[model samples]
Target: MAIKITGFYQLPHQTMPELVDFDEVFDTSFMRKYTRFRTFEKFLQGSRLKIENQRDFEALPEEKMDAWVRKATKFSSWQEMLDTATDKYVMHKNM
Candidate 1:
């Protein structure tokens, strides 16, 4: 629907290659990254992902979550976001 309007159905058609290596180094425990953010709501505001609460986020259907992640962050998937956020957190902490 929206894709039809934008005429950019191809805008989000990138094939996400599997991400490795950093998966082992990043710590993605619960809302750790969200906590590091100014606020959880603010994080969502910058993104298209939406849910009423933690349970809502968890209960979101797999396809919907995947699409939300694709729309919500710069990364191709949530895992990439996690890995990048972890790196940023580490770098900022050490600075």
Candidate 2:
């Protein structure tokens, strides 16, 4: 029972643990609009996802960053440009 309760308490936190892109939060709009965003904001505020420091977030490489964002957004573009943008955002904190 203790394990079950602990599992239940952590369910929401575990819902989208691989979330590297902010846009991924929008993918769940059908089920609960803005709910994911709110949860993500909470996660950020609590520093549970390493978003507390801009430099730390910026430290991530662009290609890796874009790979996640591209999966989350419906943006249409050349894969190369997308890759570049992803890196730029990681380094400079742009969308």
Candidate 3:
């Protein structure tokens, strides 16, 4: 079966929502396993970082967010998490 992964975030001042790249990178199972949250919105909530909207999300300190992601998921960075998850998913799917 093929799956299409997609997620969007809209800023309060924007008329249209924008695609979130990481959310399109993998399936929900890996997302849930690594982040313990089903969606990015939920992940933000789990972080306890007070990111209630797009502006808040954008306002977050990059280094701090990276550190939190690393600590929460045991990955070096969000890119690493996505890469690892994709790799693992491919390996499992082929088995």
Candidate 3, after superposition: displacement of residue 89 in Å? 12
Encode model 3's per-residue lDDT on 27-58: one tens digit a residue.
57766767667765566667877676666666
lDDT of all predictions, in order shown?
0.44, 0.36, 0.62
lDDT of 3 at 6: 43
Candidate 1 on 1-95: residue-level lDDT in tens? 11100001111233553332232223344235433424334444445555555455556576765565576444576656655655564554457
- What order do you get sorting by TM-score, best first? 3, 1, 2
Which candidate would rank higher by TM-score, 2 or 3?
Answer: 3
Give the residue spans of candidate 3 off by over 4 A: 1-27, 82-95
> Which residue pairs collide in model 3, if any?
none
For candidate 3, what is the total of clashing residue pairs? 0
| Candidate 1, residue 80: lDDT | 66
The C-alpha stretches of model 1 lying farther than 4 A from their native spots are 1-50
Measured with C-alpha atoms, the lDDT of residue 68 in candidate 2 is 42
lDDT of 1 at 10: 15
Q: Report how far off residue 63 is in candidate 3 (Å).
A: 1.2
